[model samples]
Every structure is written in structure tokens, then in C-alpha cells.
Target chain A: EAGVTQFPSHSVIEKGQTVTLRCDPISGHDNLYWYRRVMGKEIKFLLHFVKESKQDESGMPNNRFLAERTGGTYSTLKVQPAELEDSGVYFCASSPYRTGPTGETQYFGPGTRLLVL
Target chain B: AQTVTQSQPEMSVQEAETVTLSCTYDTSESDYYLFWYKQPPSRQMILVIRQEAYKQQNATENRFSVNFQKAAKSFSLKISDSQLGDAAMYFCAYRSASGGSEKLVFGKGTKLTVNP
Candidate 1:
């Protein structure tokens, strides 16, 4: 019954460095999503995973960002050569499989705060 | 494209009092969902309440409730018996059923301060 959890609650790295943020979805959850809130900006969706397959990644900002979910249990978002603008709080959410037309409520994790110096 | 608007950037309410946070959204589709999420200083996004467009009755969760107006494309949250714990950044969100991808469009949040 645990909620989604994230790793490295806070991270600091120099510009052009690499940082990896991890997330562990709740047990039995089939859908996982990644979102972020940059400086003074609203939270925005990054990508989604259904099981081991990436259901959608249209929200991904650019090529420098990479996300992966192995074994459908956990997820990782990696930023290479991070930019100053990449500094923000990254959130991970998970939900059970949707069986009906009703929208499923997603439970969020404590976000990972990344600072690109 | 769908967008959510929260006109009030900040609001405050006395403890045990009631406060309403307004939100307006624009969308072409009729079937959609609206949500109110609270992010306290801890920065965890918590679901407050949600409203389905096809349902006429509003959604209520304990002290949290929503006033959903389909015609106005407006969804406002009313928190009754506001407590110090209620002080947080509340975001109004919109999700479309026809978008194929389950993505939430969020508005710039409104910070709520509950006075004890």
C-alpha cells in the first residue's frame, strides 16, 4: 500500500554534467508518469510508461533527456550535459490499470529536486 | 489545445473559515476531467478533488469540494474548515478524454495561506 517513491530527493551538478533520477512505482501499478516543474513554471508532463513499454513520450523536452523503465517496476530519468534551465523538481506518479472509462487517480511521489549549476 | 487558467495567484483564509479558488479551462472536447491538486511545502502533489464533465453533480471529498460549471468551463475548489495544513500551492488541472494520451494540462498554481 505504499505510494510512489523517488530517489535522490535533491541533486546538484554543474552545467554539462549528468544526473539520474529514479522512481519506484507502487506495487501492481501498471502506469507510471514523469513530470517536472521548472523555475516559476507550472508542472509539465515528461513521459509515461505502461508496464515495460513506453506508452507515450511526446512530452519529452529534447534529446538530452532520456527515460527508462526496466521490468515495469521502476523508472529512471537521465539528463546528459544538463543545462541551467533543467534545474527543477521532477515528480513521479503511478496508478493501477484502467479498466473503465473513468479516469484513474494517480498517486505522486516526493519529487526529486535537481539543480544544474 | 487545452489550457487552464488560475486568475488568483494567491489567497488566504482564516482557520475554520471557507475559501474558494477559481479555475477556468478551454477545450473543444465535451468529455474531459478537472482536478484540484495541492502541493504543500513538502512539494508532493496531492489530489484534492476531481470532477467529471459528464456528471452534473459536483465532487466532494471531506472538507474539499468543487464547483464545476460546464457551460462556463469553470471549476473552483472550496475548502471548508480550513486548517493550517491546508496552506499550500493548489493547482487546477484539465485532462481530455479524446487526447489519446493521458496527460494533464495544469494552470499556474494559486498559493493558499490559512491563518490560524
Candidate 2:
């Protein structure tokens, strides 16, 4: 099976610019998640999507960041007027549905390295 | 809120030797999941191993294994017969067992260097 794939392995943009990162989860996976790690910090969760519905988005840093899953097959994260602190690596992961038995294991992608100058 | 902690910032172990990396977490939930991820220099996060909160047995995968302590809220990883390819940033993670919250909470990470 093909693992999760992310577009634009590396992105470099200046402050006040806009950039969108995309992620394609494994086929048939119902759970998709977004996470990122800033300099000197651990990887933090951003949001999660179950099928076409967003299950959780409490981890989003601010309103400037937006995420959408049009058809539930893939997802996009957009940042408007990006700030210098927005530079970091954004990761996308997905897992099969949990059936209340054993917890599911999430598969991660290579991640996109975003640098806002 | 659940939080994972990795006390070691970095560690080095000679090839063919065994090394243990420490991790601790704080959570009020009785059931959850713990994971160890290895991010190589290529920057890809790979799942090394995982342990369920209710499982009494430690998890093992090939040369990688975990020491899970429920009472202490501690989960550690041990690499046996370490290889040069094992050098990378190892992160400890936690996930809530209830609800649809599948997001993982990660620790600061420990950079493991394998010396040949």
C-alpha cells in the first residue's frame, strides 16, 4: 500500500505571503491528521479529519491558518500572510477507523518543510 | 491536557550495544496509547513501536522494544544491537483512547546517535 504523500517537500516564502500544503492519505483511510514542529519544540497536533468531517481542530494556532478536505480523499492547509514564526515542518498522517478493540496505528508522510522569511 | 516528556535531549551508543531512552507522560485518562517514532535525517517519521495503556505486556518489534510502566506513567524505548541507520531523533507520543481525538501529543524528542 502507498503511504501518505505530501506535496512540495520544501517551501520558502517571505512574511505576508500565502502558501498552501496538501496531503493525500492512504486509500480507504477514514482518519487524517495534521501536525507540525517549530524550531526548538516538539511536533504539535493541528487538526484531524474523519472522512469529510473535521473531528478536531483545537490545535490550530490561529485564525490565519485554515484547513479543508474537499472530498475527504485529500486535505489542504493554507496560511495567509504567513509570519516568520510559521517556518516549520508540517506532517500529515492517516489511520484506519478504530473499532473499539485495539487502537489504530497512524501512518505519517515525509512532511513539508515551510520556511517563512 | 495530555503531555509527553523526553528527559534526554541526545544520546549515543556503540553499534551492537543496547541503549535505553527515557520518557514520561502526564494524563488523567485511564486508557490511552503510547508510541515511539524515529525520524531519520531524511526527516520521515516512522513508527518504531507502541503500547496500549491497558496492556500489561511490553511491546516489541524486531530489535526495538518498549518498557511500559502504568503506575509511573513512564514509557521508554530500548534499541538492541544498534546500527548506524538507527541514528535519528526519537520522539515519544501519547494519544487519548476515548472519543474521535486521534491527534498525538509528542515529547521534545531525543536525538540518538549510533557510533559504529
Candidate 3:
């Protein structure tokens, strides 16, 4: 089985521009999550999705940031009017929807490095 | 509102030696999980090892193992016979086992360098 995969491994844009990062979780996985890591900071969770519905989004930074999972397959994180502080590595992870011990293990993708100048 | 802390910003160890990375977490939950993730130059986060709070025995995976002190709220990773490939940024993370909170809280990470 393939691990989580992300698109546009690196992105460079100017401040105030809009950028969207995409993630395709492993086949048959219903749990998807997004996290970000700023330079010199720890990785923080942004949101989570179970199927097409959001499970949790308390970690979202602000109103400018939005995440969606359509058809319960892929996820996209959009940052409108991106600011300089939004530049960082965005990571997407996924796991099977189960209550067993193995269900807690999340497989991460090669993060997309976003640079907003 | 749990937080993970990795005190060491960087560490170095000679090849074939052993090195331990320190981590401390603050959480009131009795049941939780701890994890160590490795991110190399490729920038891919890989799970190295994990420990479930309910398990009294420490977790071991080949050359990687964890020293989990539940009382002290500490989780440390020990790499035995360190190889050059082990060089990377090691992150300590915490996750609540209940309340349907699946998000992981990560530390700032510790960069490890293995000298040949």
C-alpha cells in the first residue's frame, strides 16, 4: 500500500497570494489530517477529516486558512491572502478508521514546503 | 492542552555508539500515547517508535528503543550502534488516547548527527 502523497513538493509565492496544497491519503483510509511546522517551531496540527466530514478543526490558525476533503478521497488546504508567517512545511497524514492499536498509527507524506515572500 | 518538549536542540554521536534523545511532556490524561519521528534531508516524517501509556514495558524496535517514564512524564529515544543513516531531526510527540483527539502534539525536535 502506498503511503500518503502530497502535490507540489515546494511552492513559492508572494504575500497576499493564494496557495492550495493537496494531499492524497492511502487507499481505503478514512482519517486524514493536516499539520504545519514553521521554522524553529514545533509541528502543530491544523485539522482532521473523517471521510467527507471534518472531525476536528480547532487547530486552524485563522479565517484565511481553509481545508476540505471531497468525496472522502483527497484533501486540500487553501491559504488565501497568504502572509509571510504562513510560509513553512505543510504535512498531511492518514490512517485507517479503526479502534484497534494499529489504527492510531499515522503515515505521513513528503511535506510541501511553502515560501511566501 | 498537552505539550511536548525536546530539550536538546542538537546532538552528535560517533558511529557504532549509542545516543539518547530526551523528551518531556505535560498532560493530565492517564491514558495516552508517545511517539518518536525521524525527518531526514528528504523531509519525510517517519515513525521510529511508539509507546502506549497503558503498557508498562518500554517499546523497542530493532536498534531503536524508548525509555518511557510515566511518573516523570518523560519519553526518551535510545539508538544503539548508531549508523550514519540515523542522522536526522528526531521529534517527540504526544497524543491523547481518549476524547477522540487524534492529533499529535510535537516538540521542536532535536537534530542528530552521527560522525563516522
Candidate 4:
């Protein structure tokens, strides 16, 4: 089976530009998550999508960041007026609802490297 | 709140030798899961091995295994007969086994180098 996939393996944009990162998860996966690692920082969770609903977004940093999963399919993360600090590796992961919530093994994608100048 | 820490930023192991990466986490939840993920040059996060908090026996996947200390909140990964392919960034992660909190908390990561 094909694993999770992401778009635009690398992105370069200005500090005030808008950028959108996309993630296509494995088929039949209900739980999708987004995480990012800023320069010199550990990878941190951003948000989670269970089907078409936002299960958890407490990790979202601010309103400038937005995430959406329509029709319970792929997901997208959009950063508006991106700042220099937004330059980092954004990783997307997905897992089935089986194995309970926390027990499920997450499969990650080849992260999208965003560079803001 | 849960936090994971990796004390060693870098480690090296000779081929056919063994290497251990240390990790510690702080969490109030008793039942949870600890995992070790390997990120190679491709930058894809790959699950290496996992240990359930309730399991007393360590979890092993071929040459990779984990030493999980529940009381001490320590989880270390041991790679035996290390190969060149084992040289990568190893990350320790924690996940609460509860119903609502399912996100993984990851450490700063440890870079492992294999010397031939």
C-alpha cells in the first residue's frame, strides 16, 4: 500500500506571502495530524483531523495558521502572511481509528520544507 | 502536559556493535505508549520500535529494541549489530493511552552515526 504523500516537497516564499501545504494520507485513514519543527526546535504538533471535523487544534500557534480536511479526505495547512519563523519542516501523519486512539501507529509523509525569507 | 527529552544530541556506533540512545519523559498519565522513530536522509519519520506502558517485557523489532522503565519514565533504544543504514536521526516519543489525548509528544532527537 502506498504511504502518506505530501505536495511541494520544498517551498520558498517571502515573509509576508501566503503558502499552502497539502497532505494526501493513506486510503481509509480517519485520523490525520500535522506537525512542524522550526529551526533549532523539536517537532511540535499543530492540529488533528478526525474525518471532516477538527478533533484537536490546541497546538495551533495563532490565527494566521489554518487547517482543513474536507469530505474526510486529504488535508491542507495554510499560513497567511507567513513570517520568517515559519521556515521549518512540516510533517503530516495519518492513522486508522483502530487500535484505539493512542495505540494506533502513525504513518508519516516526506515533510515539506518551507523557507521564508 | 507531556515532555520528552533526549540528552545525547549525537552518538556513534561501530558496525556490528551496539548503541543505546537515552530518552526520558514527564507525564502524569500512567498508561501510555513510548516509541522510537528513525528519520533517515530522506527525512521521513519511520517508526522503529514501540513499547506499551503496561507491558513489562521490552518491545523488540529484529535488531532494534527498547528498554522501557515505567517508574523512572525512561525509554532507551538499543540497536544491535548496527549497520550503516542505522545511521540517522533517532527520536523518542510519548503518547497518552487515554481516549481523548492521542497526539504524540516527541523529543529533540538524537543523531546516530555508524562507523564502519
- Reference-based TM-score of each model: 0.97, 0.97, 0.98, 0.98
Give a tens-digit lDDT track for model 2, residues A1-117.
899999989999999999999999999998899999998799999999988899899999999999999888999999998999999999999999766635688899999999999
| Fnat computed for model 4 | 0.76
How do the residues A1-117 of candidate 4 rate in per-residue lDDT, one tens digit apiece? Answer: 989999989999999999999999999999999999987778999998999899899899999999999999999999998999999999999999775645788999999999999
- Clash pairs, model 1 backbone: none
TM-score of chain A, all candidates: 0.96, 0.96, 0.96, 0.96
- Residues B31-115, candidate 2: write the lDDT tens digits: 9999999999986789999999999999999999999999999999999999999999999999888865778999999999999
Report the error of model 2 at residue A51, Å. Answer: 1.2
Task: Mark the regions of model 1 whose C-alpha exceeds 4 Å error after superposition.
Answer: none
Highest DockQ among the candidates is held by which one? 4
Question: At residue B92, what lDDT does model 1 achieve?
Answer: 95
Q: What is the RMSD, in Å, between candidate 1 and the native fold over all Cα?
A: 1.1
Candidate 2 chain A weakest lDDT stretch, 10 residues: A97-106
In candidate 3, what are the lDDT values of residues A1-117, reduced to their tens digit?
Answer: 788999989999999999999999999999999999999999999999999999999999999999999899999999999999999999999998986434288889999999999
Per-candidate Cα RMSD to the true structure, in Å, reads: 1.1, 1.1, 1.2, 1.0
Cα error, residue B46 of model 2, in Å, equals: 1.1
Model 3: per-residue Cα lDDT at residue B73:
99
> Once superposed on the true structure, which residue ranges of model 2 sit more than 4 Å away at CA?
none
What's model 2's TM-score? 0.97
Q: What CAPRI class is candidate 1?
A: medium
